[model samples]
Target: MSGGQTQEQTPEAGTTETTPKRLPAAGRGGGGPHFNVGMPGEKSMNFLPSAKRLLGRLRPYRAHLMGIVTLAVFSVGFSVIGPKILGMATDLIFSGVVGQQLPPGTTLDQAVAQARAAGNDTFADMLASMDVIPGVGIDFTRLAQVLALALVLFVASSLLSWWQGYLLNDVVQRAILRLRADVEEKLHRLPLPYFDKQPRGELLSRVTNDIDNIAQSLQQTLSQLLSSLLTVVGVLTMMFVISPLLAVIALVAVPLSVVVTKQIAKRSQRQFIAQWQHTGALNGQIEEAFTGHELVKVFGRQREIEATFATKNDELFKASFGAQFISGIIMPSMMFIGNLSYVAIAVVGGLRVASGAMSLGDVQAFIQYSRQFTQPLTQVASMANLLQSGVASAERVFAVLDAQEQSPDPAEPARVTNPHGRVEFEQVSFRYEPDKPLIEDLSLVAEPGHTVAIVGPTGAGKTTLVNLVMRFYELDAGRITLDGVDITTMRRDELRGEIGMVLQDTWLFGGTIRDNIAYGDPGASEEEIVAAAKATFVDRFVRSLPDGYDTVIDEEGSNVSAGEKQLITIARAFLSNPSLLILDEATSSVDTRTEVLLQHAMAALRADRTSFVIAHRLSTIRDADLILVMESGRIVEQGTHSELLAAEGAYHRLYHAQFTQPVAEADGGDAESDVVGASAVTGTLRPRSPVG
Candidate 1:
């Protein structure tokens, strides 16, 4: 099962169409801001585990984390005290002005005694020591001292906050760096099926977007969370100290604000998930459309593709707007509740102040503390969504990291001492899924130096056969052997070291031509690289370029023609000099001239080496030692081209379909000569062409 394909169904006409069953949607990895629940095709991950794993990532930075916490404590402590100290100044100014207007018998000390009687002994003691400045009638000396200390505390707090942020960035960056490295390493350990079923954009988003979300959230939200928490605690403590009555009034808003924030955030989680999912889906669509732009234009489906893209984009917009709008309400809602509490505190604190139950300075301090308390409440409420998104992203990253890795190399494994390239698959049985049998009890032998050609239509087991040989997918039963040694007993690396493959899809990295040709054996000398290039006839094309072997191939090998890229890959295989070679439609994309040249090159490369050639062009493999025809993942016919043609089997029809046309001539009219004439007409059998 491929994506979007339904299961087999019986029609009203009573015939069943066997559409293969699809893979389960779970464990197919992608990363973005996603909801933990209530979304189509998204896995609901446990928040606690994801959060625990995220914190585990920070274990290595425990010391730095502790230092940051300590700094946060100091930073908040000084900041919290500044408002209280500033309140003292306000009281000092108020008392000095009021004392001068007092009755003739009242002294400043007596006024302080009266303040002590008013249940504010702290304020009374602070006022008794203040120095009165002449003519000013206020304590400028005490005010200057308090203001100076407040300035120092504020500056110190600001410095510590900056240092904490700096340290946090370093710690967070290191942790995310390790996380990215782990995700990349996990990619290598993942099985081929994981890549086969998942889209590239999806996987890339996991590695990039998901991790980035976690990083951004940690960087911004982590420190702010700590600061907000400390501020809330510290402000609440100061509020109660200023006046327990007003503090009780401020506390009334806490539970109410929390209830409102929780309600909105719960709805926003689903929307966030939908938003990111749609974003990822849109990205995948755009990637496909752009990568296959020529196909879109040639097929005149540009408008159709655009419409599909617009639909996905619209969904993303709606989801994003909903999530942000819902989450956006948190700040203002908390602020509204805080303002209501502020009104209540003001009216109540005024009555208490008029009764001389509280000083002007204490009331001012209480008001500031109330504001400070509600500010963190608003911040925490806003951070709720970011933290949710982070946890969601963390779950995605952990999903990949926790997925089943490929089987490890066995301890003290068997090693192929020397490879002579005799390959065999005996009684092999395998299937991608149990219900869909691909290969069953298959047996085959390729003697040393034999060019065995496998010809099949689409969906034949050609690729799977090669994959089995390479141990990409383990066999369900029986064994594959190289030189009569069961390949599975040997480690995958040691087994693959003796074999080389050229796939239909050629891959070239961003490097010079020489570098790509020498990729199989990176240490190959300049002379060896040159020889391999010449052997595969890639030297002709190299010489045509301005920089010869030094010419750079851009990413995806777009700078080179399809035929040229194929030849370069062949040269890469030639450089490896393996004892066994597998070519799966290696020449499918090449021109007739290049295919002819490649055939000769392959002949040279296959000398004294067992080779498996998967070909659609029957003309190129007419002289193969054996030709196997496959249908529905099983070999239906096997023999030399001439022998199979003489038998008038499946291979015969396929051969004639490609090289021979329907004619009045009977079947017995010179089969060998007719083959040669057909080959000449197709220009596919000629090895020495102009590129030579």
Candidate 2:
């Protein structure tokens, strides 16, 4: 059975009180300020550690990563050379235009000296810097070759970039697939108590939303970050080759951009953590509201639920807005810094060009390289937001994977063959919390082929008793044995395989009715399923429907009545044909007539099988071989029905309270007559109608 605490109730002295384990307001794995909603706080994960761990998940894909990096390098190399090649073409055109204007057969030095003597010093200085012949015109052939080389380099760069992106995507997908599988396996390895403390929606978010966020973050940031860093390095190198002075001026923006990005990212990281936290919290609230919507409307708490939802939604909005607003500052800040460096480089490069210290083509190419350098820095800063958000999600997922797992199964498991269904609890001690003892040093025995009925009030540890028998929880002390074999010595699966349970709250997945019934024993044949359904009285109602057993159950099973759902669950248990059966208020949802029919069916099912039946309705257990009345997690009374009633102990009182009531005398009647009437009723007492 799924683990849960019973509803809150004040316990008398010497009685056990089962309540949910409370988490500290800021505890790890506990919800934040809104702990009731199951949200983790901002401190749940460290950014650097989580990011390192996330990257470590890709260690197995080293070869693929190396290939991607090599591709990025080649891609950036080709792209960086394009601007320089285009600049060479510009220089060729300029030299050719100047040489065509020069006189043929006149030395360039003579022309430059004449210009200088004619008071054209600036033009003469520029001419002196040129490598043009006196009578040469524009070289169309060389210009075409340079332009063609630039085009080829750019196309090659684009092809390499596309291939790199494809490889990165493939690597990320495969890594995430392994991560998802690990999470799934980890969930199964965790004990039932682990789930008891976690909210359903919060866990679901960790498995679904957080994982997808991690995948998206990796997909968007990995390739872009690699390419952007490479671009920055390649562009910076080209800038230095073109003009060292301008390259140094462009370097001034690097530190400033890093500072701006770092400051904003630090602030935004907390907000992103809070945002995802509230998202899980809000999802938990929404799940609760929807699951209990019928109860909420019945209790007239729609307004209350709506108010709570709005409050949580507002919290999510605040966190989301803060996160986006903070991270959003990175782009414009980096851009502003880059623009400053651009202006400074442009001014310095223009002066060098005018003084003939650098050619006009080199100045233009340097300007282009400076732009390329800053653009990549801006991209890297922008990717910081995604990287931070992804790391936050990765931390959440890692928490689950790191959770304490249930004790391992025995290496050499004890096998039970031809099981006799003899279950014994010897000196068993257990409690959900250390300070609160529910069951201690308890011992009980159920002989093979006997029906044992356990009766108790709310929070009396009745279900806990059955849970221990199933080994859903480990014992704190002592041991339980099945067929003379210590249950802990056997594998949990092999132990549970011998027992079948029919819980009060039935569960049905989205599938055909036949499939849900066959879930008990997947290998069951069609005839076997029909036989089990018929024995449980499920076939009668199912046959009345148009599709009979083929009818599809919706996710919520809304089309099926509560009684029908219970019947389906009962049929499932019956189909398992186990040596032991546990019926936990199995007939609580059926009509009195159906209850009578189910009782007969269960009696047959229980025949020759060791069955543990937990019920509050006394009438259902009257025919059991042994009836145990439990109080405060101890057996207060145990005997046959008649024997317990004759003893007039706790069991007798419970029976009288349920079966006998005071009779009201008519108006003007004597008090003695009322007393006599009430006595007579007690003598001829009858059980109340069973609850449906």
Candidate 3:
């Protein structure tokens, strides 16, 4: 409404592609397109402050996170000890064997046994004793001490790892649990237009598949990543201490691998983003097919649907393989580079030791450090896809969460007490699209205990009026008054509470029939619910069900017929006992028998309340009240059926063409029969008293 556009039928929403149409960041880090590389997605590109806001959720659980960090440190600390001890063993065995070929005061067999025993000591003890005496030959006791501590560290690593898993599981699961609930609540609170814009599959992906990614990434993959990182750090530190030259030489592989990894990961990230989008499109196709299966079968579009699915499925498969193939190449390549680095170190360090420039112990420690550095790097490189994919999913989620909310009602809201059901449209006009008013300068009034029937073509804005009555969409001009109080000033929830609406589509959740009858009015007693059901004629057929009121209804009430679904909706409206009732195509799809029953039920529901009926059947509301015959967006004629028929105007032509079907002569002579499709009233009309 704020924009100057004459008509904006499909308004773009949320942080959409508003930038100067970024020409898909040239293939592979500006490599001029031949390399077939993909650009990094919005992850490292966008600034989403809402994500930073969501991080506040982690604050309360900081203590638990700190503990996880400590446990990880301890676990890595223990894990690194094993390799360090092996290096010490190597050094002790190599030193003991050189020149002397054993330890002091011992034969070959005795010296070998003593050296082996010394290699088993704690490395710390070995270092301490070595510091005490320069050039001391060998000590089997120190080696023994290092080996014993290494064994203890290995066992401790295992214990700490188990604890890490247990605690991480509890924390991540609970975090996701809270997050899911919060998201669901937000979904409920968001405006209806938001749902209309987003595809059902995309929304479903957020609730289902997207959350699943978060769980896997945070729970298992993240733990592996963290531990691997720590392992790399610990090994690198020790390697540097052993020999800075070797440490620097071995790390050539690390930076090179990271550069390569970043390139490959970018491609993989794009592929994964494509994969998720394609998956959603595929799911959308499937859902659309299933929902409209009846129409599809009737129209014989099964082959067409299948072809659509196959095309989407192929795209999904290609995306999946492309992403996995790139990500999969990283680890093995890292390992290859790692092996080459090891060979380089083995050659270079062997010479340094032989020349007595570096100790054999130092060379061993350098190799140990190399593994520590390489391992976590490899692990991180491999996890690049998961991390990026998670970010892609986050972007989609934030897109939803960041959408502008519905406009709120005035702070000083008006209230209607024991409303008389009198409604007046005071110069009311609405435009879902700007300047293309659906209901232009529309004005009408419904008196208490009177029926106001609106008859119009499919897109004539008939349903829009009903929606406005319920305040589902705000009006663009003028005010709608309920019992002389401005509807806009009233709290939306309160305003809706006084109106009962029967929509074209009848929705039922998975629950007992009784439960659905009391859906919004859950405080109602079963007896009251049954009474309402009977009043709506739902009780008539529900009694025939296997379990009657207790029947376990499937979600969407899929187990029921269109007629029964309609009756259920009517029953729900009856239970509400609102002051104003609206029926939009209430019995459009029902058979004559069900329509009659629905008519009677609606009569009961409308008793002592003003009602608005968007009808296609003239026989349903022929007894009395006014009819507003709509053409395009305006009310062209208004009057009772007989008066309009007598006047021979728009209502008359419509009545003859759609509603006035000849029926078997009743006791009062000829009568009009009910028919849904033939209920069209002409677009033009003659003037008459607007109300019966």
Per model, state how many residue pairs clash.
2, 0, 18
Query: Residues 1-692, candidate 1, lDDT per residue (tens digit)?
Result: 11101111101121122211221231221111111111225555466777788978999998999999999999999999999999889877876775555445656577677777888776555456454322244678988998899999999999999999999999999999999999999998886655554445556677788889999989989899899999999999998888888988999999999899989988888877776667656655666567566666887988988887788789889988998899898988998998999999889887776666777778888888888899988999999778778887787777789877878988878866767799888999987666667788899999989999988765567767877888877888989999988888888888888989987667789999999998989999999999999988899889999999899999867789888888898999999999999887788768888788778878888889999888766777888999999887788999998899999988887767556632312353345444454554464352343764
lDDT of candidate 1 at residue 388, scale 0 to 100: 75
State TM-scores per candidate.
Answer: 0.87, 0.91, 0.83
Q: Lowest summed-lDDT stretch of 10 residues in model 2?
A: 25-34
- lDDT leaderboard ranking: 2, 1, 3
Candidate 3 residue runs with Cα over 4 Å from true position: 1-57, 95-144, 409-412, 659-692
Error of 3 at 329 (Å): 2.5
Least well predicted 10-residue stretch by lDDT in candidate 1: 2-11
Name the top lDDT candidate.
2
Clashes of 1: 2
In order, the Cα lDDT scores of the candidates are 0.77, 0.82, 0.70
Please state every model's RMSD to the true fold in angstroms: 7.8, 6.0, 10.2
Give Cα distance to truth, residue 218, candidate 3, Å.
Answer: 2.5
Off by over 4 Å in 2: 1-38, 42-44, 100-105, 134-136, 662-692
Q: Per-residue error at 390 for model 3, in Å? A: 0.6
What TM-score does structure 1 among the candidates reach? Answer: 0.87
